[model samples]
Target: MCSGFPALFFAVAYNNPRDSWSQVVPIRLRLLRERFVVFFGKGSYGRDTLINTLGVLFAAVIPVAVLPILSRLYSPAEFGLFGVFAALVGLGTIASTGRYEAAILLPEEDDAAVSIACAAFLFLTAFVSALAIIFTLAYFIGVGSVRAHSALIGLGVIAVAFSGCVQILLSAAIRKRVFAKVSFARFCAALVSAFLSILLGASTQYAEGLAIGVTAGYAVCALILSRVVARQYGGVSLPDRAAIYGQVKRYRNFPLFSLPSDFSNTLATNLPVLFFSTFFGSAATGYLTMFQRIWAGTSIMVTGLGETFRQRAATERQQTGNFNRTMRVTLLPLVLLSVVLCATLVLLGPKLFEVVAGVEWREAGVYGQILAPFVCLQFVASPVSWSFYIAERLKLLAVWQLALLVSFSLSLFVGSKLFSAQGTLAVLSCVGVVLYAIYILISERISREENKVS
Candidate 1:
């Protein structure tokens, strides 16, 4: 009788198009469709995002597609080790550039931007050398992980060098608006990395092989981007010392403020893997890494959007002295998309992992389900967080980053002491949701402030 009632209601609603439900539902659906079209339509902010997203989509697809095979070929412990290695490389890359690469998109003059790029490279070379020395010292002192994985750590230093160069060059490319070239470089890097990882996995079941593959990928990406940027910027001659010094002095806030902010943020993001590896076990770390890898694959679209948004927001801010409208409009679509994706992960992530990767990965899927809310909020917040840079709110951003780091550290410590690993992740996810919500509110407020000032 209940089923019949629903069917009869639908029939009556359809038969009488003037009915409230019929009229309102179709109008709402039509409005949604129109918004979707406009969001991705020609000559819109979304057009640029779509282009970058497609590139990221192509790049992400290869690694994601190969994950099942890699899972079969490598043990969870090896993947956990690889995750740690990658995290170290990430931290190193950020330090190597001193975050001066981020300033490349700020200056109006190409010559000024080039000077910043040159400064970043100088920092990279010095930092990489220091990193090599530090790792060698750690190994000699019998730091267990360094001594055990000296070869992998050495490869990580090389990866750090390449990744730092790629970061600087990629920023130059973004400044030049050559996104297609950037996309192509990313695709090639992903292809090479996937191939090498598989080949190395089949030959030797060591985490070093994963590190090698990634380093090679970065090498390839750096090579391609270097050439593209060189050509776009009319050959890569060194800028004069005065020019470099002047630009460095002008954008000194980047290294002074953005560097630590970025470092803290990166540390907070990677703290869990380190925490799990330290206290829980490599197997637990591997499970967390697997979930992170899967989540990263799904979030690449947001990454693309964020990248394009940064470039666009910078330009709009420069021209109009504010980007409040663009930021607000972009938020709605991102929020909607994140909700849909996170809901799916919560509902089906475990089963999906079991079917696609193996039964061993089912736990990773559980992590995905638990972290869905956090991931969703992060996805929505991250794209807009660049507003801090656009609005030159470095001090405020730095403060937020410090707070995030402290909160995350406390949550992880307390959760680990009190609960199981899965429960720890649940606690961490709840904390993340709250923090990321705060981040969104802060960013929105910043945008509003800029609008008022403008």
Candidate 2:
């Protein structure tokens, strides 16, 4: 029968009331269905979050589903190279827009928002051009990794540009409340990247193929989201020079404070891969990369929820001048999710890796077990920490990010000297737990103080 058959049957039974069983069962089922519909209906936070989460789920699953095949097709050292290349691209992408994209949702005026987007694009162009120049010089001088893998220089530049564009366009989409489009864009990117990676791996079996797939995926995502933003915003236009400069000045704090904060945070997060590659060797870096990929798969839901939370919290702050209630509601579910994730990883991490990605990846699973608590806490803290942005506490946020960088670097250094790769990860995880806990506490306090002021 059709998809609506069960609903129709229940409705008819409820109306007819042939017996007590039919009457009570239909009524309860109908009520449950109605509740479900309402809870995820249009314009509801639940609906937006569900859309984003499902999108992220599909995106995350694609790469994860190919891991078994990819593991067999490529060597650990090749994966390690891909991991480092990704880290560099990530760092560049974070700086590309000069943090202007983060302010896209903060402005009240559509014109102002458009101007900020235009400014972000301008920054992105300059940043990418400079990156290309640097990469060219590095290739000529045979400096660092770029000299060894000249192809990566071009791939890095392309990935950074596309990734930066995706970030800017995504902010515009979020502001316009076109969550489904955002979700679709993400899924498309992931699908394209995963498919290309597998296809290229089978034929080329080169690390460059992996990076090529990722860059192509970002290009696709950027193209899709650019169209979505164009339709939603009635085509993005560059404001007059005066208008663009005005918006830039108005949101100067974003570049000044948010840029550094974001850069530091990204650097801290990606430093371990570089460290592993440098000190522990490529195989170790590969294992760590695998663990991070698995962690990323689990955390995509949190990332999606956080996107919705940021938009909702921003709206609430604009209306009520505080988002304490929204923050609290978001926090509880995240904590519960964290608990479940931690328990699962601690118990089944290595075994799960062995079964899914082959015996060679068991080491990565051990890394997962060691880092589970830290990542779980991170899953909780990252969303709540948006309070720093909401409350205009950019300076404080920058300080905290710097502290995280220092602490993380120190932990990695000390742990590496004193212990094995697993030991170093353990130490890093411990430091992360403490820092993330402090972050959550401070975010709560910020929300409370904003409430009191409001």
Per-candidate TM-scores read 0.84, 0.85
lDDT of 2 by residue, 1-454 (tens): 4335566565666777577466656667888889888978788778878887888788889998888999877778888989999999999999999999999999898889999999999999999999889878878887876767888768989999999999999999999888899989988999899889999999988889899999999999999998998898885566898988998999998888778888999999999998999889988999899889877877777776677778888878878878877889999999988999999999999999899888988888899999999999998987777788778787788889999999999999998899999999999999999999999989877876643322
The Cα local distance difference test for each model comes to 0.87, 0.87
Structure candidate 1, residue pairs in collision: none
lDDT of 1 at 31: 68
In terms of TM-score, the best-performing candidate is 2
In candidate 1, what are the lDDT values of residues 192-230, reduced to their tens digit?
A: 999999999999988887889899999999999989998
Candidate 1, residue 105: the lDDT equals 98
Q: Candidate 1, 291: how far from true, in Å?
A: 0.7
RMSD of each: 8.6, 5.8
Assess candidate 1 and give its lDDT. Answer: 0.87
Scanning candidate 2 in windows of ten residues, the lowest lDDT window is 445-454
